[model samples]
Target: MNFSSKLLENAVAEFARLPGVGQKTALRLVLHLLNQNKQEVEQFSHAITKLRNEIQFCTRCHNISDTSICEICSSHKRDASVICVVEDTRDVMAIENTSQFNGLYHVLGGLISPMDGIGPSDLQVDSLVERLKDGEVREVIFALSATMEGDTTIFYLHKKLKHFNINISTIARGIAFGGELEYVDEITLGRSIVTRVPYENSLTK
Candidate 1:
């Protein structure tokens, strides 16, 4: 797209780099920002800058946080012995919104997708195993999407964690095949968590 100002073009280009954003949408966003008052624009820019510079990942669960540890990991009210394993931070937020789970979480960062070249090593698999080694955890709930990649990741995790004397389960299949937790309705997602099944049982189906 042609632009009268190089600065406006550059701003649009940067915005277009974001996922799901096209050049037109980016340009519209840039134009909208240009219409905003100077103070509002500066505040918006400062907030994004500060977020990028100051956000931290929780060392324990790999969740994005303002501090080294996420509030969920440090909360005394949560069930420390029960850990829900999810594909990413978005899944954590989805589950939290349901208020069905009262346990800690271990974000895998990403699912094991062979086609995408994402393997167990590419994820936070080692850290999850290390967390289990201490034996404070007695149950591990798999709250991944119902896609092939999600199943593969859960299978790999189950193999790695089976030796531990803990209950290994997957959220019940209330979610349709290929459905992501982040997209499922809150009632369905919450019911799935409440009615989880053993990993081995799911294998038979």
Candidate 2:
């Protein structure tokens, strides 16, 4: 089979490196981009470069932002006493789109998965504990996934914050098993927030 230029192959390989994008899709995308005008391609390249160079994670919430703190953390209209803990910035965006939660958020960056070599210490858990130390927070809502790794992270966080006076809760099981927050619809996400329940240990009773 006749092969394309090395430049086209390189672009396809780079696109394939993105999450969930396979080689075929990557090749198709590269071909589409190659068909575009030079000016358009230049604009696309510039935009992607700017995204990497200009964006930064918020120091407070760990969400991707242009500044040190994300807009949600810096906004005065949000409820400072309530904090929702999410697995990543995507979950934060999902919850924000629902418009059901008005509180701030703490992004763990990932769940506790021993198989993946990601533990509590690897996440932003210590920052969460530090934030709770002030005693200003009234409630903490966990918006993590329903997977075992997510459950383990939740329990670890609960144990760590048990001594605190704040109420700890988890979003309702409206999210289906193995469902990712990024794929859940806004209605289900909003309902989950509205029907959140307190975390409790049945064995302790």
Candidate 3:
């Protein structure tokens, strides 16, 4: 952890602060960047600066964007009436990569975790309720992860949206297509069987 130069030490410290990055990894990254041409390093620094300074969040879904409204929200081809409720913009990106969902998204900003001091009020819950009250979205699909926090958030949202006319749904949680039944967890295998779809319905998709 001892760097010959204070500048290198500072850079390594900053890099180490990033998630999943250890001190050794940070030191390696800093060394790698140090070996790069001055112009390339300047460009790298400028790009980071630009991302922090110029990034905007979508007014509708709270997704990261370069404008007030994200491209997906503004797209005419997407189904605005069906909103996919997710934990954050990363979920949006993951779903978008699938090319399977053609619906709009509602980023909750973060999940409800009382232990972490994050409550429903800390998220975009009010805005989502308002969106539902506006009577535009007909179907709301919950696409949260299968964790305790994710489940808690979904339950809270379900209660808040129970009276709404929108059709409530959740992304199917089960074993992967190629996964073996023996290797799958008991809860997942049980849920998969309980939510098993008709063979004909599965074939169509």
Candidate 4:
């Protein structure tokens, strides 16, 4: 697409770099922002800049946060003994929306995808093991997506965690194979969480 101004072209290009955004959508966004007041545009830019500069990952669960610890990790109302393991902050948000779980969460930065060169070392696996060492946790729920990578990650995690006294479980197959937790409906996700089965049980299926 051609833009009359280099500045507008640059802006649209940057916006188009975002996932799922095409050149046309980015151009539309840039035009919309251009239509906004100077103060509003500044505010928009400032918010993005501040987020990139100041956003912190929770020290405990690695969820995105303003402080060292996220509100979910710091909350007394959440079940400290049950930690729901998810792929990222987006999955955490998806699970939270269901209100089916009242537990803490551990966000693995990503799954163990050998094809993508991501392994256990690249994820937050070590910190999770450290969390279990304190003996405060009783159950660890594998809430990863139903993809091959997700299964591989969970299998690796199960091997590392089976020695622990805690119960290891995976969400039920209410979610179809290759389904991502973030894309599933809230009711189905909630039921899956509620009906989670033993990690070993899942292996036999």
Q: Can you write out model 3's per-residue Cα lDDT over 172-194, one digit (the tens) per residue?
A: 89899889889999999999999
Report the Cα lDDT for residue 200, model 3.
85
What lDDT does candidate 3 reach at residue 46? Answer: 100
Q: What ranking of all candidate models by TM-score puts the best one first?
A: 3, 4, 1, 2
On the 0 to 100 scale, the lDDT of residue 138 in model 2 is 96
Worst 10 residues of 1 by lDDT: 196-205
lDDT of 1: 0.93
In terms of TM-score, the best-performing candidate is: 3
All candidates' lDDT scores? 0.93, 0.90, 0.93, 0.93
Candidate 3 error regions (>4 Å): none
Query: How well is each residue in 70-163 modelled by candidate 4, as lDDT tens digits?
Result: 9998998999999999999999999999888999999999999999999899999999999999899999999998889999999999999999
Which tens-of-lDDT digit does each residue in 57-106 have in candidate 2?
A: 99988998898988999999999999999999899989999888999999
